[model samples]
Target chain A: MKAAAAARIMPALVWAAAALALWQSGAWLLQQRGVALASSKLPYPYLVAVALFRNAGSLLAEAAVTLLNACEGFLLGAAAGVALALFMSLSATMERIAAPYAVASQMVPILGLAPIVYAIFRDENTARVLIAGYISFFPVALHTLRGLQSVRQEDRDLLHVLACGRAASYRVLRLPAALPGMFTGLKAAAPLAVTGAILVELMGAQRGIGVLMLRHLYYGPTHAALFWCTVLLAAALGIAAYGITAALENTLLPWSRTSGRRQGRGLR
Target chain B: MSMPYSTSSARSGKEASGKVEAERASGVSEHVAVLVTVEATAEGALKGDGEAGAADAARQYGAADPTAEAEAGVELGAAAGAEVGAEASDASAAADDRNRTRTSPKAAPAEKGRFMQQGTAAWALPLGAGLALAAIWQAGLIHAVLGLAAYQLPLPSAIFRAAADNAGLLFRSAGYTLLEAAAGIAAGTLLGWLAAAMAAAMPRWGSGALLLAASLGAVPIVALAPIMNLWLGDGLASRAAVAAAATLAPMAIGSYRGLTSADSASMDLMNVLGAGAVPAFFKLRLPSSLPAMLTAFKISTAGGLIAAMVSEFFYSSRGLGYLLSNSVKIARMPLGWACIGAAAAAGIGMYMLVQAAERRLLLWHPEFRRRLS
Candidate 1:
């Protein structure tokens, strides 16, 4: 089983290694050809490592700021979305009256929404959080609504028979039943929060990986390694947020885990 | 445990209020379920084309019809609806009371699954809710609470006036952004399908290859935007590239799922016929993947539009995104609001177009056909 898991991972690891080597050599070739921005945009992979090591302090600081926004926005958005979905599930009228508009509002791109928000707040950081929260909340609400509504009638009825009361039913049946769907929303929201933070940062910011990336962009070819380093840092933050949520889903929702149980019991 | 639980029963305590409120979830289990399903359809309708075909498949199939197995216990569900309806919210509670007073006497308990009869027509309440919300915004209720000024929260009338004033510019920008989204979606879906095909055809390295592609979903549009802008320059191509990148993961994941999701029974039959992997894919998997691909399209459609718009945040001269941002910078709140309205129109237009195409193409699929008469 371990061997099979390793085999599954091997190709991607190999592909990534090959891509990295190609990138390093390709940049070298581009430099030989005197192509502009090659070293800056596509720096040698080793130089990126060095830049990471050198700028560890500043990069960490900026990454912390950006990640903080993503995390906070994620928490707030998920809460708000859950609340909205609760309202949605509470009454047929609310679901009927609200769902279409909720769906419509989400369809309008958050990027379009961001500028209007930025205009309102006039504080870049505040706007950044709102942008992140805005992007994160929709998926949470959608998935939560879907999750809550999708709760099995038997389970709900069981609680009714048990005289477990509504709160207990919600606690035991609805919320837990909704976990998988909520996870789906959380998964979608995480990376988007990162994107939102980076985006609003483009408009203006004093700190965050977004600001750092922008600063590094115009830093000329001389600071090429740092720019790529900043990009890597930003990418890592998003992946980390996504990965954390995915890990939480895996841990908390054991019934949904496809690989661990199915392939495990003496299959090999 | 029973004593403590009963003491806190909002569900049990509902009758104690001495006010007659309709049980939201009644013996008409199908009615409430229909409300959720129709609303789900409408929700999926707002996203890009064909996505709901897959999502709703999982939803509807997984949620087996409750009334079938629980016909005896179904009547016991009278307490369940009241439980949720009883949750703390003065607004919805009041609203639910009004609904019960008007209709509880005549609302039929149909044994037959004719959900379209009385249940679906209740859209009026929500529509009224929408109007009431707009009225609140127009009356500055939000501004009063939030303490934000007119500049921050433009009234609907002001936004409408602004939209009428700048009709030409707003429409042009919306068209421009929509074009980029359309082109990007086409390119990205094609690329993604090819990648999925490559992975599915070769299971040896398929999982790894698919994983790498799926991980691209983790790469946000913002991170891709400035780099694409740098590589392609600040033109339509850059936004398109960003859109393509944004959409690629969903398409790849969806197509891969569709390609591989062919029933094991059909797969074994193919194996019996001595069909090679590539032939099996074309003969069985490709056709099977349509719903998934459509679902991916639905998911990616909204993604592509947002991607294109986000890409334009830094380095573009045209599109609703740029105009929206520019208007905000200049303190033109109404113009910015107009841009949002135009963007909404474009989004709704895209969703409808995709849904129509999905219905046309997937007429044979039971899920899509359910919406047909």
Candidate 2:
């Protein structure tokens, strides 16, 4: 099993190394071609690495701001989503009326509301939290409901014959069954929440990596490495969000590790 | 555990504690046996009997019927209806409550698989919900709670008026954004499918590519937007590139999973038949992958539009994102809201179009083939 796992990941590691080498050489080639903004367009990987080290403190601080807001919004949205899912699970009528609207709303370009939300709140923190929460809501709600509903009729019947009431049935069977689904939703929503926070930051937030990103971009080619660093930090934040959720899944539901791993792949 | 179960069951008012006590004493061992069998069956079901499991789940939850009906009218009434034309505000919440009450009694019968009887009529509830939501916004309740003035969060009337006023410009901008979205989705899906095919064919190097694509999907569209703008220049191409990059990962991942997940039975049969990789892929894998590919396409459709719009938020002269940002900068809340409305319409329309195509293409697939009762 270990060997198979290593085989699966070995090529990806090799690909990462090849991609890094290609990036540096490609930047060099563009410079040789005398392309305008060549370095800015694709800065050398090492220069960006140096900038990353130099700005590590400030970047991490800004990222913390974004990450903190994202976490708050994620928890808020997750609670709301779970509540709604539970509400819908109470009656098929509620699900009938609500699920379509939930699915339809997701079809809309939700991130487009960042600017409007920012304008309305006129406070960066509020806007960031609101947008992140809103972004995370539907997936969590939908997936949680799907999970809750996935409890088999046989299990329900067993509990029923055992004369267990609804709450007991839920506590023993439904919630446990739903845990994997909830994690799937959380994993999907985590990065999106981060993205939503950064987007709000871009909409003229007071602080955060996004603000620094925009600031550095306006400063032009000289600040290109720092700009790239901010971008990388933003990407890292997204990955961190996902990683944290996956780790939570691992710790909380050890039995589901194999299935959860499979679902995690499907999620990407 | 037994004490709580007995008390809870007694409170449920279905049966008395004496009958519950009798059943509990007799059924405990049977319940353990049931659990054992359930675990075994669940493992078996997970192996390859997904359709059976889904059917069982749908039957249990009574979700299959209404879900089918909902999918048909979801784009029409749920999203576009909320935004297009709404004026009145009074008693909207009450109306919504009334709609809910009316639907529940009917929903009971519909759960028995009578949803087809209502057919197109099933949409009325969702439509009402949309209009009610719109009316609530028009009522300034949202503004009241947010403590924002009219200029900050425009009422539905103002938004509708703005949309009507700038009908020509909004439509044109929507078209431009839609063009970018469509082009990006097409190009990205094609590229992603090719990548998936490569990954399936060459497990060593191609899996790495798939991982790369997945990581790319995690990269914020905001970050990708500027880079693409720099590389491709701030034009239709740049936004489209961003959209393409945003969409590429899901398609690659989804289709790769699909291609590689062909049943071992079928694979062995192909091997016995001495079918080469290309032939096997074309005859078996490609057809099998349609569902996942279409699913990816649907997701990419939404992602593409968002990427195009968000990219436009940074550097663009036209498109809904530019219009939205520009309107907000000028404190034209109504106009910004109108842009959101247009984008919502476009998004819903494109989604419906893709869904219709999915239904058409996947008619042979078991999930779609099972007629909704």
Candidate 3:
């Protein structure tokens, strides 16, 4: 247990070490190239860390806006996904009909759609949420559909033999079996929703981490350390999002976690 | 030839998702030789109802067969567990998994044409829906309903006209973007594979490295766009770099899973035979990894395109994203729509291309073989 804990901590150390090495090498390369002017544009890792610590409050505020947008979108998308999955599962024909569209929806670039959606909604937060919801829903829908269909024939037979109605069978048997699958969908959606939120924020958003990152970038030549610090915060949020869902899955669906193990539910 | 255990002569109407479920249950990959062996054993279990050697399948997946766990290291143990469950369930529907690939999805869309009393009618449903959707947009129904202007939802005809008028330019831009995507994916995939391979050799730090890389992938592309632009400048290199960065994580994660899927029993045998790690990798690990690698490639196709387009949002003078964003900025809604159309077509085109290649290349594997039979 202790070893595993230490092992868990090692990646961060390695990542930090890597960052330092890259910074030194980059600094060295710039010096060799006589690009002293450009050297200030790529800050040392420590400087970025200091900058991050200094601006933590503003960054946290921005993150709150982005997270809220993503969370609302996540719920909306997950609900839509569940509804679609339930609707599709009742009829194999619907599942088939909707499958291609699901694939096509995924195929359409959400980045391009973000601007168009922004134009339509004209509300920054709504547009960001819309794109987040669009991206988040796909994984959930596919996984939920997979879970619903994964009901064993014999288990389904037992429900039939018990004279269980379609709704009852779905509620009692199918949903239980699909919980793990749904969790898989949720986990995949977390980071994706954040990415979507950020992408949409780029189009036009007065607030949010996306805007902050772009703002950092726009002023990067002057504030290189601040930009890197913002990037680090975004990375931390993604990791946090991933960790949260994974933790939730472990806590909520222990049975599915143990039993299905791989069931390969993640799409992204 | 690997045993065709799933070649159940009885192809009937029991078109369940048994196969898809099984594959999905397993890590959505496994066209390599090792999976072929697994399928063979499972096939025997189903065909003879346990008369065939279940021991073989059992042994292959046992603690000794280290390759069973050779997949995305993070999910490797889970995948192995899932495979065992799938193996149990798949024995009954081994034939179904194959059969569905060959048939079901293809017949789905036409269902809404009528009552879908027959499966074949399902094909037209999606196509019809798309055409009808196009018709609605063309008729200004969405514009009227949504209270939107012509600029927001350009008519299909106007977009088509723009496409035709600038067909040559659109085509050229698409080719340029596609080339950049292809180059990026190729470079990224290679780098990812190498990283995964290096990591696979050292189970401790390697997996962590991979995890870090993957999490880095979750960093917003919008954030990376400007930085990448600053670093690589406004050349094709910047766009390609963005695409590469975007695609690298998936490839690394996938290939790591593939590379590590080396069977320990085989490795033991190689040890006895005095074969070096290099020889064993070439003989055993590489073939087993082909499925995961292919799966990764298939996934990267559309993603790579999206990455390229997103990167184009920042800098560079070419590609569909540049055109789309530029046209939209200039209020040439039709032209922007045309760019969106070309970009979507390119993305879909690449996705289909990769899928087709997977089917073609892995034809001998049960997943693809079911379609052929």
Candidate 4:
């Protein structure tokens, strides 16, 4: 397992180095031509790295604020999603009533509602959390419902033959079976929740990495490297959310490792 | 052949979702094509059952064969669990024995159609529920319950009226945003596919490249949008660049999975026939990868549009996202809601188009073929 992980990490390191080289050269070429705000357009990788190291303390504080709200929202949304799925699973009629909209909601650009949500709440933290929850609610519900529905007729009968009650069937068979799908939903939602928090911040929030980004952005070329630092921090926050969820999934549902690896549920 | 979920030879009418889940999780994608195809297939079956009086069939069958329900449950579990490997075949065999005696050939099509329709008719109740919710919202019940004012949460009628009033602008803005989305998706998909192809050809470095792409998926569009604007300026190029960046990762990961996931038995066969790598890839891997590719396309389609809109919120002079953010800033709640509705409509419309493309392209795939059977 250690060797396999190393094998995976080796190429990623190489790829990252290659990407940095490409970016540095591209920035250099642009600067050579003296394009307008050349450094701002594509800052040197080393300069951006320097900015990142310098701003680490403040950046970490702001990132923590955004991360906290995102975590709160992710938990809220996930609980609601699982509850809805379980409720819908109680009867075919319930499933019929809720499932389509759940699916349709996925098709809708839920992120586009971010600004509207921020406007309505008029509180950055509340709006951030609400949008995150709202954005995550549908995927979790849909995937969880799909997981619940995937319960086989025969296993259900075996439980019935053993005189298992509805609660027992769910506890012993259905819930465990739903884990793989539920994790899929959770992993998908984590990054979006962070994105939601950052998006709300971008929409005139008082604090968080996004506010810093916009602040630095307004200053233009002088703050180019700093702006790039904020952007990278936002990206890192999202990736961290995804990584943490993925790690949790690995630990909690080790059985689903192969299944999880099989499909990449794309981000919205 | 790592067919994680076995395709039951005697798929009962009620097993459409089970089938959909297995197919989706086994490989390919979770959203997009699976649900859309299952929707049409379910509707076809549901319309038939609706004509036959569903309760009557339930009543008769519920009494006549208790095991029938049990057997259906088994099939559902077998498909849903993603059990994989050897046990998959065993479950399928058991499912075969249980279901074979139930769905006779003569009644198979109608019953199959009914269950599938069960999937489609599932939409009906949701529609009714939506209408009820809309009516309640329209009546100001939601506003009252939430302690919100009408200005904060406009009535559906007001939103509709706003939509009608600004139809021309909304229409044009939607077109502009959609153009950016489509162009970006096209470019991103092509680039991603090429990247996947390159990775597939070079096994040593390919996994890392794919990993890079997957991590790229985690980066927020908000981050990408500004950088794109900075580099490309506040034009179509910036928004489209954001959309492309947003979409690139999914297609790369998906197509890579598809290309590499070709069963070893096929590879062995190609080797025995003295087939070259290019020939084998074109003949075997590419064709097999279509479902995954199409699934990625579906995801990228929706994602690209959303990414484009999100980027527009940053700097665009027009487009639904710009109009939406602009209206909300000025407290034009009704117009904002209208833009939201239009963007949602456009999203669903594009998703449907991708689903149509999936149907056209994937007729030979086992999952789609089962829809016919």
Worst 10 residues of 1 chain A by lDDT: A259-268
Candidate 3 regions with alpha-carbon error over 4 angstroms: A82-92, A143-185, A255-268, B1-123, B197-201, B254-296, B361-373
lDDT of 1 by residue, B273-344 (tens): 999988888889998878657756766787888888767766888999899878877889898878877876
**Model 2 Cα lDDT, one tens digit per residue, B227-330:** 99888988899998888887887688668756865777999999999999989999999888786577567667777888899889879999998998888778
True contacts reproduced, candidate 1: 0.39
Candidates in descending lDDT order: 2, 4, 1, 3
TM-score winner between 3 and 4, please give it: 4
Error of 4 at B56 (Å): 37
lDDT of 4 at A170: 96
What TM-score does model 4 achieve against the real structure?
Answer: 0.73
**TM-score attained by chain A of model 1:** 0.83
Q: Model 2 segments beyond 4 Å from truth?
A: A1-8, A82-96, A107-112, A119-122, A142-182, A250-268, B1-117, B200-203, B260-293, B367-373
The count of residue-pair clashes in candidate 3 stands at: 20
- Supply the DockQ value of model 1: 0.21
TM-score of each: 0.72, 0.73, 0.71, 0.73
**Pairwise DockQ winner, candidates 1 and 2:** 2
